[model samples]
Target: MSAFSLSQALAWIKAAAQSIDANAAHLSELDAAIGDGDHGANMARGMAAVTKKIDSAPPADLAALFKSVGMTLLSSVGGASGPLYGGFFLELGKQSAGKTELDAAGLAAVLGAGLGDIRRRGKAEPGDKTMVDALIPAIDALAAASDLAQGTAKAAETARAAATATAPMLARKGRASYLGERSIGHQDPGANSVALLFAALAQACA
Candidate 1:
């Protein structure tokens, strides 16, 4: 088995932060159409804080690493994203307890755990115009892949497509839901961010 190293995992984290930073404006622009117009900024700030936390504390294992990211986002990010995204990572920490590296199956478990918590906390399902839209499909793709190489790449692709697909979906959760029919044409910023992070994961592993 080709084990996914701790270094690769850390690289994924850093890359995710960088990706979010780069796409902050675009994310916020997407949010402006259907949300409070601050998702990009909020996520950028939260990811930055998570980076600092990682740099300063440098967690010892997968569990601690994910925990630091989750807690940092919870404390630093504003709005509903703080809890939803933070809870996702926290669940990752819980599932990853006592480990450093992951095989294909282990990676799937971690991702599934994260998605499970997001669904639980956000009360969102697929096509909800939320991150759940992208995450659910991505995790499913990852779980079905033959290995990490194929899995991460396929997950990223699936998430990207799912995010794009959200544009036509009616909002059923979160602030976007408040808009009802008006939310139908706009893409979900949260789903885009989920897509970006998944792309970062694929890149880091490649």
Candidate 2:
């Protein structure tokens, strides 16, 4: 699709919820290796709340939809993920305010704003072995895309790859940082969740 509308946005949210639910165990497994083991369950809970809130009330506008999702995540999720993901979506809503649909460039702008908010909230850099590793590269890929579908697909690929790359990096942030060199062999749970988010977006676009 050349443009993303409310329907597509809702689809993206649903897809994200489903993906998180499906991979909840795997996420927790990943987290158990390096950080706290609640990442999977927490993310699944937050996404489910977002889905329920959106389905029950049904946002009147695109911005409202994203804002509702953000609020739901903030209220439902736990740990650092709650605020980080919530802030990201809130920034997305802010960037998309007054717009009913987003073209390629609009999508890029929204994603970029979300990434910036995430970085700011987490005080994370690309090599920090945090979600930023996946998100920054995904945003870069999206920025070069010509349309929503292409952008989402490219973002998914880059995000997954970035998440994989995190396996070899020593943690420098969050709970994983406490592991020191021991963190190098494990994949970051937050990065994996980010990859799933982009993958869901790509599936929605498809």
Candidate 3:
């Protein structure tokens, strides 16, 4: 796809919800190793709320859609994931305001804005073993792509790899930081969820 529309955005949200639901248990298990074990359930609940919001009162525009998703996640999810993920989507909405469709450059701007928001909100760096590790690489990959589909696909792949690479890193932020050296061998739950988000975006663009 050359451009991303409202329908495609909705599809991406739906796909994210489904992917979260399917991996909820695994996510929780991953979190149990280093952080709170509620990441999966919290994310699943938030995505369900987003789905309900979409089904009950469909957004009239891309901005509305992203805002609705962001707000719903903010209110429904638990733990730090609620605020961090919620802020990401809210910033995406803000960057995409007044736009009906996004081309490659527009999508890159939206993702970059979201990543910046996450960085500001969380104050975490790439090697902090947080979601930033996945998201930053994904943003870089998306920015380098030539088209929407290719960009999203590359982003998803890069995000997944980045998330996986976080396994050996020590946590410097969030609940995992409490573990210090103990957090080194475990994968970061937040990074996993970030990877899932990009994976869903890739599928939607495909």
lDDT of 1: 0.90
- For candidate 1, give the lDDT of residue 20: 98
Tens digits of per-residue lDDT, candidate 2, 1-206, equal: 99888989999999999999999999999999998899999999999999889989999878998899999999999799999999999989988899988887788789899989988888998799999999988988988888889888999999999999999999999999999999998999999999999999999988
User: What is the alpha-carbon RMSD of candidate 1 to the true structure?
Assistant: 1.1
Q: Per-residue alpha-carbon lDDT of model 1 for 4-87, expressed as tens digits? A: 777887988999999999999999999999989999999999999999999999988888889999999999996999998899
> TM-score of each candidate?
0.97, 0.98, 0.98
List the global CA lDDT of all models: 0.90, 0.93, 0.93
- Flag regions of model 1 displaced more than 4 Å: none
- Residues 1-206 of candidate 3 have per-residue lDDT tens digits of 99999988999999999999999999999999999799999999999999998999999989999999989999999689999899989998998899999987789889899989989999998799999999888988998888999999999999999999999999999989999999998999999999999999999999
Better of 1 and 3 by lDDT: 3
| Candidate 3 ranges with C-alpha deviation above 4 Å | none
lDDT score at residue 66, model 3, on the 0-100 scale = 90
